[model samples]
Target: MIADGLNSKVFLAPMAGITDKPMRKLVHSFGAGNIVSEMVAINALSRRNAKTYRIADVRDEPYPVTVQLVGSEPKLFAESAKLVAELGAYSIDINMGCPVKKIVANKSGAYLMTEPKLAADIIKAVKQSIKLPVSVKFRKGWDHKSVNAVEFAKICQDSGADYLTIHGRTKSDMYSGNADWDIIAAVKQAVRIPVVGNGDIDSVYKAKEMIEYTKVDGVMIGRAALGRPWLIAQTHNYLENGLEPEETSITLIKQTMLEHISQLQKYYGEKMALALSRKYVCWYCKNLRNARKFREIYVKINNTEQAIAEIERFFAENGSDIDERS
Candidate 1:
């Protein structure tokens, strides 16, 4: 129950390479109302660069879109916020949790945690420069020993951030081990603004537990929904009405895969779409029977026609069979 009365609390994390417009639309079709765009470079967006503009584009995007931007400079951060507002973003999320080596090496993302003053400066600048709601995503800290998420949460709130997202692991953890929900609970305790808990929430049960335990206003999913965008609707339905989404069948899976491919084809072109779908194709088959054999063939798909053929062939061979893998 996000206070914004958005359709669902399950949010699509702003992945750097994965959450493109096509993918965002795919998730939206499956009942995600609060899809976040892929993270754009604040500096690039500040300059109104074409490539950055495309990523920040909300035209034809589903309602209440949250655009995420990354940068270390306060002025550029403020400019990017205004750019997103003009582009029709419902809210702006500052990227402080990205742990990629390049982003950290550049003194952006999680590295911002090491300098609370700069993090506050960026948030304050964006909050002051734009009329849109501003949010920040941050980690527990740079690492375990230096966990200062609570203090940072206070800084974000003090700087006028309307909401905060805490990915419970430190940058050093880097998607390793479990996300420390205890830290999330602590941060929620420290801040009055909505705290979104992100980490290790791979199931509705976990999602429910996090909401109940941490008392966070929302939950963000990253890798868990790769081929399961329906999980967003499912989470919403369960959280709101205490009902589970019917299990996705193989036939529905095939149909959804084709629909996703078609969207990708339209947005990214057939060749690039086919190549980009390789990972998602693998994710779709990861939990099915004969998945090992199916993945071996699916990963080798090189063209849209071949991809279509493989999709039909795999369902013909493994239809109605389900198991567990990733």
Candidate 2:
């Protein structure tokens, strides 16, 4: 939704289980770009489902949040868009690029790339249902041979989408190999609306590279943001101004990790947070000294006290070491 209502061009992709409220809040605190909610199922939401309501909640949030909805039915998509609007959503994004097996099997997500008619209908319905700016997130095509992002982007614009986000790989390619920025450039040339490029953008320099190569309006970062909440903020500053990213030390990472765990606890309670923090701890300690040894022991600790202790112990052992991974 960058350049529509957002003040920044950098966007955090709507990653399920990764961009939830706790993670969004953490990234926003660091001045990250537009943050999107995990995909909310419109089919369930149209029935006034309680679980979907909880997933779409952005009420009274200090940072702007875009709600991404996924489903095949146009009426249901429209209804869910209206409902999310009532929940203080800053904007709405329709998910047409998800490549998960179950999602594509349901005729939603990347499957829509093969069925342009339904994709356009869903976009039109959602746009008509709310005043919020609407955007479409899709991929290169249903497969490598069926490249249709250029055509799909045009259809979305014709259907009244305010902007479009195109991932650089086909559904068949999944997340493997290199992202095809060539297809992204093609889509940008094929449309007048602002186009955001997404796929394997993991560093500030790479984000700049994609912009220069694709001539895109903006860049969306996904997997790279894991364990590095300040990436969006850093990328934003680098792009908006001629500024370099600040150095990050091991100590700051530990503090940030602790804060993230605290938020997860506040949101999901102690028990669930304990299980969730395990994976996050691994992400945070990805390449630290003896990280494998730490992770091997950390994932087994089922209690909060032990987890916190392990985090404290790991960082204490490696003080003031800056992240050299990137």
Candidate 3:
């Protein structure tokens, strides 16, 4: 039940398509307690798919990165866990919390919450396949009528999970509604192993509030950090030092935006990175003056050079050294 190599108390939650290597690298650079990979489908990784393998690569990362695997079959989960272990992952996390319809329909993700036996089998299989610490991330249950996070927590512990993460919503809730911290608290109370609470945590204050309320070991932040990667480090510093985070300057924000695109270009190549940078720009420019108008022109951009120039021009026009949240 002891989780080693998980020394930090604030972590970045795994978001599909959003928590990629570039994003993970950026957040890690700012000092998060830990970061989890976007859910890598066990089926693809077990088959040695190039794209999936690339997603699972964390060997070169200088942080404790847990590679999260999602799929229905326990055998494929075992194979993928072993592959991730070989790739030097800090740990292997079985993703049973994702609520995407496609994932649920495949008898995976939140659907696993409906079948505790199968979920236990998956955890056992992955545990037996790798020497790394094992963790399970799951929701309260499939629906409100079926809330079982407390029971599920015990199952995860009995099946050999070193720790657990419980998002406060159910599969039916998806990402909507207020997350029920009561269930998260219940899960923490039920399990002897460490539990990290997730869902609806957007600020360092809320992160501290959730830990205090649920008594979970830590907090996992998701969408709230999309454009604000530094929030993770801010939360960490606040928790460890009780110091309030300083207001980030517009210049540094622009610099981070530039660095983000550069990292995207390095990992995904020029053309693809240009295309992908559109969403990132949208996230970064939120609430800024002319943000909507600028994004309209930005996403249509096709050339990498043009995209970089636009970023430079937009940031320059906004301001250089002040907080310009309009």
Evaluated against the true structure, the overall lDDT of model 3 is 0.88
TM-score of each: 0.96, 0.97, 0.97
lDDT of 3 at 106: 95
Instruction: Name the regions of candidate 1 deviating beyond 4 angstroms.
Output: 1-7, 324-326
The candidate, 1 or 2, that scores higher on lDDT is 2
Looking at candidate 3, the ten consecutive residues that score lowest on lDDT are 317-326
lDDT of each: 0.85, 0.89, 0.88
**Candidate 3 local lDDT, 31-117, one digit each (tens):** 756888999998888778999999998898888899999999988888888888888788988999889989989999999999999
Question: Residue 84 in candidate 2 has what lDDT?
Answer: 94
Deviation (Å) of 141 in candidate 3: 0.7
Ranking by TM-score: 2, 3, 1
Kindly indicate the candidate among 1 and 3 with the higher TM-score: 3
Which parts of model 2 have CA positions greater than 4 angstroms off? 320-323
Q: Check candidate 3 and list the clashing pairs.
A: none
Better of 1 and 3 by lDDT: 3
Q: Model 2, 96-146: lDDT tens per residue?
A: 999999999999999999999999999999988999999999999999789
> How does candidate 3 fare on TM-score?
0.97
lDDT tens digits by residue: candidate 1, 1-326: 45453557778888877888877888887774467888999877777788889889896774788989898999889888887888878889999989999888877999999999999999999988988878899999999799999999999999998888999999999989989999999999998888889998787788899999999988988888888877777787788789876867787778888888888899878888888888877777767888788778877877778879978988887785676443
- TM-score comparison, 2 vs 3, better candidate: 2
In angstroms, how far off is 283's CA in candidate 3? 0.7
2 or 3: which has the higher lDDT?
2
